[model samples]
Target: MGGDFGPRVTVPAAIDALRRHPSLRILLVGRQEQIDPLLSHCTSIELDRLAVVHADSVVAMDEKPALALRRRKDSSMYLALQAVADGRAHACVSAGNTGALMVLGRGILQTLPGIDRPAITSAVPTVNGHCYMLDLGANVDCTASHLLQFAIMGSVMVRAVENIDRPRVGLLNIGAEEIKGNEQVRLASRLLAEQKQLNYVGFVEGDGVFSGRADLVVCDGFVGNIALKSSEGLARLISRKLRRSFGLNLYRRLLALLARPVLQELQAQLDPGRRNGASLLGLQGIVVKSHGGANRSCFGYALDQAVSEAQMNVPERISEQLELDLQSRDGSVKTF
Candidate 1:
C-alpha cells in the first residue's frame, strides 16, 4: 500500500517469506480491496499464517513527514507501525514514505532509553563482506554527542546481527588524519576514543568505507545519504558499461558467455537489492525501511532483514549495552 507497486509486490514477497520461514506469521496492513486479489493466489497453509488488517489510507511518497503524521491516521504505514507498538507484531517493514515512517515510528514506539533520536542505518557490501553504516538520512545535522550515540548503536547492531566481536567503528571524515575533519567530527572522534567498550578505529575517508577498514562507519545524514546514492549510481553505471562492452561484437559476446559465471557473481555482490532493508536504529521497536522502488525479490530481502532483526532482539541488546556503558561511566546506574 505504501510502495510504488503496493500489494502487487508486497503480498507476493510476504507469501514467499512465509514459505521460507515456517514459524513466521505476517499481519498485512493495507486496504483489503487491494490486498485480497493478491492473497487469493496463496495456498490454504500460507493463508493460515497470514492475516490482513485493513488500512483505508496511505502516505504519499512526496508527502511531508509532519503532514503525514498529522493527517494519515489509518494509513497502512501508520497501522503497520501501530501493530508493532501494540505488541501484536514483533517488527514492522515498509517500502513506503521514509520520512513518514521515521516520524510515526518515533511518535508511536519512542526511542530506547538514552537514545535521543533514531538513526537510519544499513549494511553496504564491502571488499571484506559488508560494513554497517549510519545515519543514512535520519538526522541531516548532528552534534558531537549524536554522532557518538550513532557509533554506540551501530557497534551494538553489527555485533548482534553480524556476529562480530568488538566490531571496529570509524567516524566518516574528509581524511583519515585526526586533525582533518570538522569540529563536530573531531569532537565525536575524541568521545569515541575514550569509550573502552567500543573498538573505535578513528577516522575513515570515503574510499575506506568499501576497503573494510572498519566494521561500522558513522556520519551525519547529509554526508551519509550522498555517499549512499553516489555508490548506487556508480554501481549501476559500471554494470551498464560492462554489458555494453560485452555485447559490442561477436568475439566479445563469446567472451561474455565464457565469463558469465564470474560476471554473475560480481553482479550479485553489487546489487543494491541484495541489501534492500535499512534499519531505523535507536527506536524501542524494530522497523525496517525497504527501498520504495524495490521489486518482489528485493522486497523479500527487506522482509528477511525484519525477520533477522526480530529474532536477534536487536533493540533490547542495544539497550542492555547502553545501560552497561552508562553504568560503567559512574558507580551508579543512570536512568535514561
Candidate 2:
C-alpha cells in the first residue's frame, strides 16, 4: 500500500523474491482487500511462505513525517516497521513516504548506540563496479560529527556487504585542495583522518564519486541528494540519446541490431533498478527505502538489500566499529 503501483507491483516482487530465496518469508502489511486480489495467482507453496497482516491505512506519499508519526500508527508503513521492531521480521522494506519512514523507524527501532541520526546510503555505478554514497536526502543540515558518523557507518556497510577489507573513505567536497570546501567538510576531513581504522583518502570532488577514487563518499544530505538526482537525470538523457541515435535510419538500425548484446550489457551495468534500495544506516534494525517510482524488479532489489543487511548484522557491526574508533580518540571530540 505504498509507492506508485501499491500492491500491484510489490506483491509480484515479493513472490519472485520468495522463489529466488527458498528460505525467505514475506509479510504483506496492507489492506487485505487490495492485496488479496493481486495474489489470486500465487501457488500453494508461495502462499505458505507469504502472509498478509492487514493495515488500516497507509502513509500518503507527500504526508508530513511528524504528523504521520503522531497520527498514522496503523498505516502500512508503520506496521511493517513495527513487525521488525517486534522481532517478528528480520528487516523492513518500504517504498512509502521517506520522511515518515525515517521518523517512525527512529521512533520505534531506535538508532544504534552513539549514533545521533540515520543517513540514507546507496550505491552508484562507477568506473569500478560502484561506490556507496551517503546522506542522500536524509538530513539536509548535517553537523561535522554527523558526517563522521556517516563515513563510519558507510565503511562498515561496504566491508560487510561487499567483503572489502579497509575500504577507502573520502569526504565529498568541491576540490581536493585543503581550503576548497566550507568549515563542516574541512572539520569532517580532519576528524575522518584521525580515525586510524578508516582508510581516509582525504577530499573527493563530485566527479571523483564515479572515478572509483574512494569506496565510500560522505556528504551532507543537501549536496548528496542533488548530486544523486542529477546523475539519474543525466543517465536517462544518455540512454534516450543512444536509442534515438541508433534508430535514425536503416543503416543505424542494422548496426544497433548487431550491437544489441553490447547495448544490453551496458544497460544492465548502469541500470538504477539493479541498485534500487537505499539503506537507512545507523538504525538499530534493518530498514531499506525503495524508490517510490520503482517497478516490480526494482522493488525486489530493495527486498534483497534488506535481507542482506539482516543476515550480515549491519547495525551491530557498525556499532562495534564506532565504539572502537570513537573510544580511541583522545576526548577532543565527543562522539559518544
Global Cα RMSD, each model: 2.0, 1.9
* Predicted candidate 1 versus true structure: per-residue lDDT over 121-210, tens digit per residue: 988989978898899999999998889889999998888888899999999999988889899999999989988999999999998999
Cα lDDT tens digits, model 2, 2-44, are 8898898999999999999899999999999999998988999
Q: Runs in model 2 with CA error above 4 Å?
A: 330-333
Score candidate 1 by TM-score against the native. Answer: 0.94
**Cα deviation in Å at residue 228, candidate 2?**
1.2
